[model samples]
Target: MELPEWHGPTDDAELDAIERKAFADSAALQLHLSNKSRIHDGVILEQEATEGAKSNQNHIALKDNGCGEFHRLRTRRLPDWSLLKRSCNEHRTKVKYPAIKFGGQIVYSRTALEAEKATNELLRLIKSNTHAHSGNEPFPMGLDIEWKPTFRRGERPRKAAVIQICVSRSHCFVMHIIHSGIPPLLRSLLEDNSFVKVGVGITNDATKMFKDHNINIGALEELSSLANLKLGGTAINWGLGSLTESLTSMELEKPYKIRCGNWEVNVLSKEQLLYAATDAYVSWYLHQILKRIPENSCGDEKPNQANAIA
Candidate 1:
């Protein structure tokens, strides 16, 4: 399960930007707070909203552009993003998605959750997958992280190491490519004038965005919506396999034995690329199909897009 070295699984030129961004992130936020500065969550910010500021109070302004809303605060009263991150230890938080579980495994409901952004969730997922596989790096996204490139040979496993993810808006085409790595299928989506991304566990997807494609794509939602058609409903499958089965009625061909096929095989076989594309496009199509149906028919049931089953 150890990763081997190569030209590294990335292009240095491409990674340069990511490295810069990571560095800037570290610098922009402060770790220590003096008596003059304080840290608290949104709730604390609400409490500290008492009238005007003191004449001599030196304060740092804080804002969290999280979950579709921008929350701004003067550092004197609000939580410091860096502090919360330190407390969380960059841990991944599990959120709800519209997926199904069967045979002790969950299938991805891609369409239902395609609206979610993937880059927002990529770093955490990549870090987790690397750890699960016992990569050289213990944590993929922490301050001290290392990466060793390796490959899984032979018949690939269906449960190749992938943490299913969806975005807040399925329409973020660029972000999807960034999170999922540069799957050839994604390149096609980017070229297509009518391509769109759909899904639910977008935050998880965002974690892997950088490592996979070496791109941050901060504005994926806006870009995808402009290029592709988006459905207002929930994600169809939480992962690619379930999305394929639900939308195309065909079980996705599993590639790797212990992990998803070596996505970075460089010379990926046609069938492998086809399988990957199937996962992306089938879900896209299924979402479109379901969009044509009346909302009332979707039923009053409160469904989920987490861990979809094939």
Candidate 2:
């Protein structure tokens, strides 16, 4: 597998600032380990190539610089997240009757022509918003991707099945990648730096896009990074679920069920469409909230009540 390029801070001043700030945080060690793992993995791959041996997708063979022999590096497996699930009965009083209320319409495009039309409208929105003077102004686009689950161990990861883009709170376009692939207009928007793309853990999604379709996603900003920058020492690397719950006090109901659903199918179920669209829409919503917080507040400021979604 080709390792993704590290696209984080590159400028010396920015890197120094990030390093200084991150070093003061308790979670900084974890961040350093994550970056180190990427670098170490890249080095192992390079060594394998120099030795005229192809690296296995399932395992990494690293040559001991001191010794001439190569050894198989043990890959770290994450803990079973399913074991940590809480029973709904434990918090029956807290649960809402109808859990999620997404005030958005998910537009599914199964054909290329239909997908192209949606992409065109999205491009128009991006172009119209180019004249905004404020750097902190909310970008009109929120992006997210979904794919089929890989159950068996040692199996290659699946390609992205759906690329969901939310142009507005009430309007989302789901591009059926398995059926229609990425439209040229959509690709153009993704590659344009002036058009801001907001999402959580977006680098992983961008890597998949490049690996599967050779499409480069430009002008992308990870919401997690933004949150860290804004919150400073108090920041936690929260995923979509935690981030949404923290900011909006809303639960993303049955995300796992919809995530593992049959995304490769020709026609997606209403639940699948809603789940994908809501994920994208929430990213945009969170971006709006985060951007509104004053830069000097240092995690002390709450989101503006008027701007909060019901």
Candidate 3:
């Protein structure tokens, strides 16, 4: 029997209906199984389970020999970070970058070693300048990520190509994740509570980092969250672009074409470097301005010293 060709379903209900229908039709079930690879078998099984539960059935018939249990177990297993790191390292090749100007100087970390060195230098600066002081002062660090754009439909999302951490206005360390995964020293700083990792949409970044690279980004201070708290009932979720404009009174230069450029490639264009650096730099700049505002100015009746990090 010739079964109808399936397009993508519109929603979970539609998908469930389709799955339920397919389960009753052998030809349609085979066609669905043929289109989806073995890796997607878990999704199929999950749909089957959902259908079964709705019908008050304990089990669903899998025409595929007894591999249902195995598939379920495999689906629950998370991707091993060590294996992923090794795989990336094996394919890793050194990439060069043209220095882009930041804080009155051209800056870029071309290699993993250079990135690590820059991170160390930034830590030293943080220790001497910020940490040395005694008070509830937060050591503010700007954080951002760059990823390759997905050009086609149904393509797997790209991993974070590079991660930029700006500890000081004059210094931004652009760590090449494809070339070198997050270094140990940098990881320490990221997890440290004393260092406030400030970014506009950092929750999404943190989720991606943990999901893709298995790196837990602690000490996150989301600027958007801070803005909401400061504004007191103003429903404003400002992105880096708009926030920078409002805070600094200067437009941030983020070209659309450059923003969508292939960040996973071996060599990064000068524009990409500048764009990544400026994002983190702006985050750092905005954090500085936001932290300095008195509690009363933001409509906080009580001085919340807990928000003050020092």
* Winning candidate number (lDDT): 2
TM-score of each: 0.29, 0.63, 0.60
- Clashes by residue pair, model 2: none
Per-residue accuracy of model 3 over 1-310 as CA lDDT, tens digit each = 0112122212334323332332233222322322111111222122222333432223333332221222222221111110111121222222221222244222456566766776777777787777444478667788999898775779999998889877664456667777777778777777778877899889899899988888888878889777555534334546675555333334565666778778887867766776787788778766765664443232324233343222
Q: Candidate 3 clashing pairs?
A: 136-309, 136-310, 137-309, 137-310, 138-309
lDDT of 1 at 187: 32
After TM-score superposition, what is the CA distance of residue 73 in candidate 2 from its true location, in Å? 23
Off by over 4 Å in 1: 1-196, 199-202, 211-214, 218-237, 257-259, 296-310
Error of 1 at 34 (Å): 64
Ranking by lDDT: 2, 3, 1
Q: Can you rank all candidates by TM-score, best first?
A: 2, 3, 1
Estimate the Cα RMSD of every predicted model relative to the unseen true structure: 20.8, 15.7, 21.6
On TM-score, the leading prediction is: 2
lDDT of 1 by residue, 3-43 (tens): 12222122333223333332233233333322222322221
Candidates in order have lDDT scores of 0.29, 0.58, 0.56
Is 1 or 3 the stronger prediction by lDDT? 3
Compute the lDDT of residue 101 as modeled in candidate 3. Answer: 27
